[model samples]
Target: MTTVQEQPVSTGGTPSVVLHAAEGLHDLIDGHGDENDRTGRIAEPVVEALYDIGAIGVFTPRELGGAEMTPRQAMDLFRTLSYADPSTGWVTMAMGLATGLAGAFFGENAARELFATPRLGIAGQGTRPGRAVPVPGGHRISGEWSFASGIKHCTHLHTAALDAETGQTRFFIVPVEQVTFIENWDVLGLRGTGSIDYTLEDCFVPIEYSYPSLSTEPVTGGDLYRIGIGNFASINHGGWVLGVGRRVLDELAAVVRAKAGRPGAQTDTVAFAEHFADAEVRLRAAKALLYEVWEEIEATLARGAEIPLRLHTLNRVALHNATFSVAGIAQFAYTSAGTDALRRGTMQRLFRDVHGGTQHVSSSPLVMQSAGRELAGLEEGKRWVHFSLK
Candidate 1:
């Protein structure tokens, strides 16, 4: 339940803005690629550039003055941007998804009001590290969540807590100011995400500002919102990993070609050839799994039918498998490149980013296990996994 603002968001999103942002991202990746990765921060300039292109709030829905870009479009954008730099790609995906989640909760009118702010974006964690107590007009929420990506740039945070009165869970939209950000994001890869841990201490969230993340009745209705958030995140980030895999494969191919002409290079080429061919087969298979699942989900939605457990499980499998496959591909490329990649090149960074991105729970085998259990017509077994499916 969201309070409707009298002012409605304008309903218009020109494709040109997205296209421009894509091109700008390419240029930025080329110019600031290493800086972004090493610094582990998305600079203000890049944020400003994204804002100028109206690429910051893809979630708000066209009717609500947000881009309202479909999951397919956003995923493609994320993949393309990731080609230049995965860190930026990671941040972009998180921001876009956060915005979309907010749009899904904010209903129509409030969404417009929120997205109307220049350069507004959202980011937060799904895991509950605290509790929300029932209060006068709303719930007083206090919790800590880890791995909140792109928190440095978002306008709001989307979090959840167990209700003090009821064992049930509820989600909340908190203004960024209410969050106590803890700079604890050091990591092995995906450094640019700046995914620090954050805390919220008894922040009062009005009823209009909170809802269940898994609710069937979204305040705002659209094809995008109609698609459940779990499915949406699965496919959205799935595209990202596919793109990253493509980049790593392509970069390795270039290296192989460059080294082919060198004296005594045929041996390495032969080795790389084997690795590339094998990786190609695996990557293609993994990539296809994602699109197949995405298409089925869309078809189900188009038919106004419930998304079956099979589709959800398949989506989870594809996303996790794709991530695992890509990370393996990067590892193969790294081994093939050996000392060459070890010398700290783009391939090296891609190797690290791929590995880092896979660290997300979304890419974990636990998700795949849940999917397998569901497909086998068995219980989810794990309470946390079962809860997410709800």
Candidate 2:
């Protein structure tokens, strides 16, 4: 594992400032857990706090007025933020990852405009369901994007669409103003994410703001567009799951300690002490697995090599480890806390958040199956499965 630099309280950089500002926001959000579920407005405060603390630009390339931290550094940041609050960690990780992708894959002009601000939020949808038709100077894009986390606070969106002219899939940079947030993120967990629907109505996007999925051509005007999409996406999602898993483990430990003496307090005979110990072992194992995979990702980036198929498998494994850890921690905490955990409190909220975090497609069973099939030498049945950072 890489020895991450001790992040200063304030690095005097935008990323550092984000971390500094978010220092107390986690507690504030946790304090408002009830409203977070009812109004989906917790993300707004979280974004503001992140900006106040300088936590948003770790992945922003130096050329884009931000730090050029490695994937490992980004993961370290995520782990820290997640321990504070998983929702904040999730939104920050998703936006940061999107920013990194934009810096690495979008055109130079697009990169400059997108990252021009000290703190920018970008949201993305993996499924390319939008339509893009070439026109005189740009493309006419129109579609509805769903599950766009942080959409309420996003300044830009990275959307995928199929081009009508060449039938090739492409990604477009759309200003948040061009899309209308539909307030549709109703779910059991991560409700604070404000992951609503976005409607793009006949939006005209410039040609320079888009890139074909397989293009290796350099962006004409910016240095931020040097990173590849596949590799960036994998790393971003990896950090997100890692942060959430770590947070879940922390919550579980706290709950166990609090309830360890409930039934046999004076006797020190906690009924499920062994179970809690086993769960801790599993959580540690999951953390180790995720860190190993992240190290592989960092090594690949350092070598300037494309993310290989094996690395994708490893990324999937890391995500699997995160989900498994969340499930394990929740199970251990719930079992140890008994019915008390389900009451209206921090434990209940944490339980819901962890389960919600796992529902993301990045951490879904489909990802595991894809990795497994690749390992077994099965023919890639879907174009999405055929995708690799390399």
Candidate 3:
């Protein structure tokens, strides 16, 4: 188990503090992988270690006492953690994004109330809109949501709901106590995420606690929030794919090196070497493309301009390429590792995690198709609203 730091981590303009913490926790996180997989949730010590390092709020607004890490910094942070353990990286991503959104969208009163605590972790799903009925002071939300990643360790929940009368999807922040857990998170990969089902039974959420789903206008914070949640999510997903891909390749290399001296080893052949080189190029190229796209987006945001359709289109394409490219690389690693990958270990777990991550809506075939349509100038006058070109 990892030892949680007694002191709070500093976010004093030094992203290295967070990244170093992530790198240092590799052994501890990897050590708990089996336990996390078996229990369908991350171990408490690992979770505490992450919180102690202030990783749970990597993307939250800096003014609200979060790291508010830049795209490059956030990418490094996520990549480091993911390389240590995919599930740990995944849970951190979910919580960080959720907490950042809460700080960005909520009103002053809600923001103060939410960020009042020293440690704040938020987890919930927004893909499926729930029903929200308006009342005098607030809305009554009632619906079942799936894939609430990291919910078991969260202090608050951020869910999306549709107001039938207005046809508007609104995001609401509710205390974890207000929601009911269904606890059906059994899955092949990312089991440590504990992304189980949950329900809100006519939960009364105040007007101050909710924000319009498609609004890019933030109640607080600067450039980061301006990119909107969709783009933000893409950045995180891209980082995670890069990290997981790197780890898979590294592990495969170790296996190949160990087998190199064996008599008549198949992995030592020229053909195998060429194939491995190609895999390296593919993963490296994918990562470069992702970083390039983010750099462009960051520049646009810094200039106080809305991210153009072209950039949004490219962002989605970058995520798609990164994800599928990593998936291919992982496949190559597994096939190359042969029977060794069949045993229950890092290679096996990563194979499942990569496949499971591919199922996410961010990198779905439909989303890629949408990006293609935009790139081909077929979606004129349309803009991205979440994963779709609206």
Highest-scoring model, TM-score:
3
lDDT of each: 0.74, 0.64, 0.86
- List residue ranges in candidate 2 displaced over 4 A: 1-29, 32-34, 43-45, 117-119, 214-234, 263-271, 378-390
Positional deviation of residue 192's Cα in model 1 after best superposition, in angstroms:
0.4
lDDT of 1 by residue, 321-371 (tens): 888889889888888776778977788888988988887777666787666
Candidate 1 local accuracy as lDDT?
0.74
lDDT of 2 by residue, 133-223 (tens): 8999889988888878766667788788889889988878787888887877778777777778777878898887777765544442122
Clashes per prediction? 0, 12, 0
Better of 1 and 3 by lDDT: 3
Among all windows of 10 consecutive residues in model 1, the one with the lowest summed lDDT is 381-390
Q: After superposition, how far is residue 60 of candidate 3 from its true place, in Å?
A: 1.2
Best by the lDDT measure: 3
TM-score, model 2 to reference:
0.83
**Candidate 2, 39: how far from true, in Å?**
1.9
